[model samples]
Target: MRKISPRLIYFFGALGGLLFGYDTGVISGAILYVKRTLDLTALEEGMVVSSVLLGAMIGAMSIGPLSDKFGRKKMVMFAALIFLIGSLGSAFSPEFITLVLSRIVLGIAVGGASALVPTYLAEVAPAKMRGSLTSLNQLMVMSGILMAYIINYAFSGMAHTVSWRWMLGFAAIPSAILFIGGVFLPESPRYLGRIKKFDEALAVLNMLREPAEAQAELQEMKDADEVELGGFKELFSKFVRPALVIGVGLAIFQQFMGINTVLYYAPTIFKAIGMGDSASLMGTVGLGTVNVIITAWAVRVMETRGRKEWLLIGGVGMAVSLVALAILTNFAATGIMSYVTIVAMAFYLIFFCATWGPIMWTMIGEVFPLAVRGVGVGFSSLVNWGANLLVSLMFPVLLQHFSMPIIFGVFAVMCALASFFVKRYVFETRGRSLEEIEATLRDRANVAEDDSVVAGTTPIAH
Candidate 1:
């Protein structure tokens, strides 16, 4: 048998993210028609969109244990099956409630993919290449979003009812691809090591790395496995607390910063600003194009620039872009401002896709100790999706009650705060092995304990 290329492994592993992006993003276009067809009130429309998030929270919470018990590869395959079922169910829904339910099922798969893909990629990739290779998940996600935008545009010419169905049903194709491709992908060597399948883990590492490097990495994995698999107890313990804080903080900051408003409602925003349906959807395609381009660029440069720096730089750009958007909407809400909205959105995506967008996922996958990596990443994803749900459900409500300036201004403030969050908490993970990152967390935890003792206070244990 011909040896499989590592690139093929990365491609299949990341395909879940493509499904994640498509299922989440296709709604941005399909909601236009779904609202009209269902005569959805703003609250109902919000439900239709955010119900997926409800399922995502469930999936995120459950996936860690399931993936731990069964392995990452199996859970990924399971998610693909859910994607297929949900896509068909969504496309053929006969009523509003059914459509919402279908999307909830889809959200479960989305949530699982969101947590699993980054973790899987991070585990499979070598530390030297980990940042970029792990970032491939984000790239596939952007590609999926871009594909959804194009499909939405293509189907925009059809009758409203039919177009939205096609827009949603297109997801089945990629889900099928992911399912088929996952069959050939190797299991994560780290996971195999964790399970004490040393021979299997070494076999996989050998396939992916130079002989000397593979042996060394396998030894590192074996050493890391000295700690038993962690549960909630270990996760909340003092030793792991800082990594938890960083992962959860990144998750919250990434979502509350308002990139999704642009992604989920770009067409709606343009439509509100007086663009027609075709023009509005076209505007989103432009945003999606920018998203894919910048994210691909970010992947190439991720190692050299490092996570923390790009995050800070992107934060400034995002804040400025949101501020410009607030001003633009306040002073010139229509006509040429429609074009300006697209431009502002493009800048926001450039900053986000290149920095927080990929890095958030990448670091969450990196920050946790290997013993609890799956659960740590899953909990972070749960928070991320929860923030996503709140923002998604509340965005339309906010639009109803507030002016665009107020909404965007609020988002700008959050973006600035995100920069502060990064500076205060995030450490550089560039070019570091996962074990090395975990060791730093251990060192920080120990220092905190020492300081507490010196200060004459017993450290509170989690």
Candidate 2:
């Protein structure tokens, strides 16, 4: 059988991210209809909308140890099955309680995929290509979100009144594809080494890398595996805490900046600003389009500009856009104000997509050692999903209590704070091998050699 190239692996592994995007992004549009169909109060609407994130936080917390034990590929496939069940469950729900439960199932899958997909990509990708490849996870995520927008728009005119069901259920198609793809993807080599399948790890790496490069990388992973076990505990000490702070801080700030608020409540926001139902749906589609396009463009530039540099740049841009929205919206309910809101939202997404959108995943995936990669990502992802849950559950309530400008003004403050956090704590992780990143995280400038053997390879079964 021919070997699968790293790029192909990146593409397929990243399918998990599509599920993450669609399940989360679809709700923004679907919630509009859900509220109408179920006669939901704002609080109930928030609970229904945020329940998935609640499940996501749980999934994020649990999947780490499970992935480390069963392997990233298997857990990812499990997530796919979860997503499938969630899609079907959601599509058929007859009441608000059942719908929220269905969404929780889907959220579990999104959380798992979010934690693992980046790690899978970062592990398999050559250091030089890792940035662009792992960025595909975020790219696919936004793509899935954009696709949901299109689907939401397409179903807006359905006479059956089950348009939201279709929106929620459409995720099964991609989940099915991801399940199939997961079956074919290789186990992460870092995982292989952790399990002492050194030969198999070498074989997989050799298949994907040049021989000399493969051998060198194998040595580096061996060095990583030495400290991989229970590495999460060590993160609390002096030098390592900086990396932890950066990783966890980035995750928190990414959510607090209100990306999800816009993503999950754009239709509602637009409707409040006086757009009709169709117009609100179309507006989400427009922002989704902008998100995907900017993400595609950002992946290319991230490699060139370096992760930290671009993160700083993106944070500044995000703050500016949110401040613009807050100021513009505060002026009054002018006809031009609605247009300005769209422009501000679009600019915010552009800045976010170009910066923290993908870089957060890339950075988190790179920060932890081979052993703690799973746990570290899990904890950070839990933070991310938890923050997401808070923002999603509270957005409608906040909207009820405050004007759009005041609400956005709060996010603007958070966005500006995100920039300051990045400026203070973020590291330049661009162009480094995973080994080198581990070195930085361990507070060493270079990798210390560990005793390891390059195992013999057998042809992988197709």
Candidate 3:
């Protein structure tokens, strides 16, 4: 067989993120039109938009054990197939319940890709380049979102019912591409080693790394394997508790910051402030453009700047922008204020896409031990999807009962809390091999346990 370049591997491996972004972003515009046809109430509109999130929660919860048993590549390919089905089902649905069910199906694929892509990327990458490589998943995700926005705009000029169908159907093309690319991608060598296939693991590593480097890496994995036992139960063990705390905390806070409220409802918000349908769609296109550009820059710098620093900086920037946007929304409903609202939202996207958007997914992949990395990431992803579901489902309903300023202010407060969580709980995994990171975490856990023993208290995964 011919040699396959690592870049190709990264591209195909991260394609799932593209679908994840497209499915999520397309709905922001599609829902505006969808509600007209379905004659949906605020609560029913939330259901149409959030049903996929419900499916994603189920997908994330189950993907870990399934991917661990079958392998990452296979599971990802499976997700792509599901995405293709879901996209088509959604596009062709004739009624309310049918669209909701189709979206839920699509969501399972999104959730699986959300968990699987980062884990696969992290495992295949060299330690020095891991952050940049792993974040390609997020880069692709943002790109997909941008693509969706452009398509949504392209179709927004058409008759309402027809446009939404095209927006949803367009996802099928990318899903098919991801499935085909997955056929050529390599299985993760770390996973190979976990299954006791050392020779196979080394062979795969040699394809990705220098021969000597491959041998050394394989040996390190073997050494680590001797000490760490991986299973679902081990995910909650004292050794893994710290990473678990960080993973789950970031997952929840990322959504609680209310980023999705912007992604899922930007056009709606713009329309609320007195813009026409096309202008509001265009506004989201702007947001998606900013998201893609910032994410691309972030992928270049993540390896150098470190995860914790970016999270902290982005958190502060996001809170400030949201507060500013809330003030704008509270004070003025039309004229130049609508433009100002879009700008403030762009700032929030800049802070988010550059930091938490990519870093949370990247760190979750890095922090988990190889044995339970799939499940650990899965569980974290499950929480992320759950939080996303809550925010997406509630934002419209919240708007029915509360003012826009209050909603944005609440998100600003959550942004501040997320910053605090990062400062107190998050750890840097920059420039460290997966094995090295695991070893450090294990050492810390042991020391903490010893201290707790001395004090006659039990150690927790704090």
| Model 2 pairs whose backbones collide | 228-371
Distance from true location, Cα of 461 in model 3, Å? 13
Candidate with maximal lDDT: 3
Which of candidates 1 and 2 reaches a greater lDDT? 1
lDDT of each: 0.89, 0.84, 0.91
lDDT for residue 451 in candidate 2, whole number 0-100? 14
lDDT of 3 by residue, 240-276 (tens): 8889999999999999999988898988899888898
Candidate 1 per-residue lDDT, tens place, 12-93, comes to 9899999999888989999999998889999999999899899998888788557877799899989999999999999999
- Candidate 3: residue pairs that collide: none
Model 1 misplacement above 4 A: 459-462
Where does model 2 exceed 4 Å of error?
A: 223-228, 231-239, 332-334, 444-462
lDDT of 2 by residue, 50-116 (tens): 9999999988878865888789989988999999999999999999899989988888888999999
What is the Å distance of residue 56 in model 3 from its true position? Answer: 0.4
The TM-score, computed over Cα atoms with residue i paired to residue i, of candidate 2 is 0.93
In candidate 3, how many Å is residue 281 off?
A: 0.8
What's each prediction's TM-score? Answer: 0.97, 0.93, 0.97
Error of 2 at 172 (Å): 0.7
